[model samples]
Target: MAGGIEKLTALKVARLSKPGRYGDGKGLCLQITKTGVKSWVFRFERDGKERLMGLGPLHTVSLADAREKARVARASLIEGIDPLAKRHEAVASNKAEQASNLDFDTCVRLYIASREAEWKNPKHRQQWENSLKMHVSPHFGAIHARRIDTPLVLKALEPIWKTKTETASRIRERIERVLSWATTRGYREGDNPARWNGHLEELLSKPSKLKKVQHHPALPFAEIGDFFKAVKAEKGVGARALEFTILTACRTGEVLGALWHEVDLENRQWTIPPERMKASRPHRIPLVAATVALLKQQVGQDPTFVFPGAKQGKSISNMAMLMVLRRMKRDDLTVHGFRSTFRDWAAECTDYPSEMAELSLAHTVGTAVENAYRRSDLFERRRQLMQDWATWCSTPGVKPKTPIGSAEEVVS
Candidate 1:
């Protein structure tokens, strides 16, 4: 428009360009090429530096609109910003959409519906509904997803984080996930206000450090030596169940879901088929010496499970073992805490490799690339490690001391 742009004059820049783009003088110009294209270009010099930047082309854009764009760019330059930087800033700022007509309920419902089928278990769906009902829906469900900002998001999570840190952490994570979903689908915009990583970490205590989150209440690894002495002093189904858990490091649910077909005493392994695993993959748990000893002790038992319950095919209730602690007046500790107890002793008391420890816990080993190149599961190493873990736990008498070593909690 300023000079020679395919012979498009400043007076006719409006007529030549499209609805959304514009052109102006002062070396700022926008025009469609002979191929009916649209582009924004600015010709300018700053601090004795001259440069040209192509803004955009002119379909669905008008000449006057482009002139306004040029004015904004020039003003930004006067205020010590490069036009190119201003353009990127404008794009970023433009992401926050107006939400006068949006509703939070509909956004959450759609988010839940979109993800329901992908979740492996119904409890996943139930978790979504529970978070919404308990935390978000009560407050912001009536508001709009686009209207969700720092203060509103804080309101949704702060009360719960203050009182029930773990639940609040889940609710925050859930909201962040849902809001991210909405942003990609066009229901909202800007950075997620619910993100906890760099943003909310400043606002809230880490879930791991929070007392509510740490309350899985495990025995100190030092105390585990004494706990085993006490366990050997008493004998029953509950004691055996504790032995099985200590040997396998399996979740209470996974051990409960176990069946005779899954255990191969001959193979010395418990192949937890995919359906029983939280990860939905077949987990081959290498049987250690203690695990085999426990299974051999149960050989030819009438029940189908390696750890049998009073009922047929049902291993045992979670509460059955939990109640054991309650009866022993150690309700302060948890059944799942034994795994934490094992991890602590492995970390603080032994020279075991970190991968061996992780593999003993059945955790995925490395990064995707590293894992691709390193295919081995270190099965024998973990097998030996588990034997050592079980040996330490079931050790008869090491002068049983106070149950306190590595008091950190593990909640899975």
Candidate 2:
């Protein structure tokens, strides 16, 4: 195997100082750079392309060591193998093996960090971390992500699957996502243990079957007029915000995150951007005179927020309206429940079309195809419906003259 190898000796290599390659035969050479720094190189031709593989510097790799490395490379070439490509494969394998040791908690943190920017809401991010810490982390937070199996995932979810099905379902989804991310990153392999399809579905009861649909406790539509009258008489920004929310039939977060910039008093409209909306689509609310008047009362409060919090520059706390309800001895009612009240009144007591009521509430009216054809938000019709609602809300003992069974009733 020697052939023309061992052409350069140790004593000759040490004395070689010119800025050029000195061949030691068999694709091995000593390289002297322009800066007088010395290194060993293995120059080989693969598929007619010459490639230089660095062995090491003169200070680290001795002449004998470089010879042994070159000999191995020649042996590999004889076997029709590229030593450089083999080294790269070995390095990648080592990295994957190290990544396999990444713990569940670490994976969760990394996954959340990677996706944090995409999640617009701080509360949503908090829910992810908090739910995992409270429910999942306790079970197998320290376990290696690759080792997490169906039984381990079940251990975390079984206790809550029946008692807190919704939360358990969310945790299961989060775990599946993390495991999927780990798999993609080469930290884990195989199917996701937390998957709810054919895998976990056979083990755990369906979330829908385990949990009953729980509606927010709402005030009866008949009592909303009296409730609205009483709430109007109550003090603070919360009461006014609550009044505006009811009149607009908006969600709690939509009302709380309301900025003065979103409201156009001249146009009698409030535009909520897509990021803040539940459906991730922009919504336009047709404001009634009652809502406009209520908002006007709040003009001097804060420059940014429509309903300013006690602290400067922040919007009102999410619990502010609920606290107002508590103060009014209406602990049984939720701020969200007002939307149901409005929907009921629109369905049972009005001559307005159901689509008008749905549009006023900022709800999707029909299928995607139907919505594409029905381009209009029905703003003009919604405005009239909202005005009637506001007038009824302001009237304490007012009854719906157009009952569901009456001749004047048009809504079904």
Candidate 3:
């Protein structure tokens, strides 16, 4: 409270020309910059550091206003609070409150914008936007995203939950993500009503219960050789992709997304990177002679994608393999079914251990304790099993004679 005498009048402040701190009284001063602009400042000491809090421009904040602000700031200093820090908190609180009023559509846009880069597939962004637009936005697009509750979410989901179970599930998940983003961004508060584990589970029947479990139609193990013959007879990138998929027993995405760089011809192996895999872990495949031959046929001098599409620098469409199956009039089987066929063939006709076969399919197997001890991928053992499978597929009428080795011998 001790400072310069109250020497500043409105007229004196208005006419002041000196470009320096002009004290009024009790830590209040008029600051004139070298550019001739004037403002008010309240000087205080906090934790041994001198701090200046801006009151406002002299043109807008009158002498009386500046004095009152300085009084409040001094009072806060006595209370051991930094008045400038308190003002910052107030501004931030106001901004958060304003942002919380953003409607569902706007929040969706912001959430997508913030997270689009992290999504692996560009099509995933389109799927999110389309699902929200088709199912959610029509009901709650204009409602404040924070204001949405269980009833509002149910309103968007109930009509389709039973009828379009898959689509409804996707919409519910997307809503949960957007609401979660909103809450984390300080735009919303409380539990996310869109969550399924405990909240929506009570409201809606389980998706599995609503819709019958539909497995991908698979080729029977005994008929794999015939299917392999038909797939090999066809030509084009799609056909090659399908044949490679069957040979490797990999997921369709892994085969189609394959690049020449991932293939090591010398090692007879294909390494699928973690990002493109379903388990999000790197999987190594032991390529057989036939698979290596197939890769040699598909390889070009400077290829980006092993299975190039109609568009330059792009992989084949996700539906390309399915169309191949359709064109061959084998609509009874799915492209993914080949994995099951390989699994069956390994289990029944070969002397390979189940662990080796599972590893061949890139599946996580064994108990946690067992896996902890099983550090190796059993890559060499799997190479022989895959070789036997490739030989069986290529030779039409020969039943695979089990190799003369016990599971223990091969695994050890």
How many pairs of residues collide in each model?
A: 20, 0, 0
Model 3: residue 32 alpha-carbon error in angstroms: 22
Model 2 compared with the native: what TM-score?
Answer: 0.77
Which 10 successive residues of model 3 have the least lDDT summed?
397-406
lDDT of model 1, residue 305: 74
Quantify all predictions' global Cα lDDT against the true fold: 0.71, 0.89, 0.87
Candidate 1, 357-408: lDDT as tens digits: 7767767777879977976766666676676677677664443343322223
Per-residue lDDT of 138-207 in model 2, one digit per residue for the tens? 8999999988999999999999999999999999999999999999998888999999889999999998
* Residue 213 lDDT, candidate 3, scale 0-100: 78
Candidates in descending lDDT order = 2, 3, 1
What is the model-wide C-alpha lDDT for candidate 2? 0.89
Error of model 3, residue 154, in angstroms: 0.6
List, residue by residue over 1-412, the lDDT tens digit for candidate 3: 2346577998888889889999987899999999999999998887899999999997899999999999999898889889999999999989877866999999999999998867777888899888899899989988997799999999999999999999999899989999999889877889999999988999899999988878888887777787789888997889989988888899998988998889999998999998888767799999888998888887782378888999888999999999999999988989888888888888888777888889888888988798789879988888888887887787676665654336777866
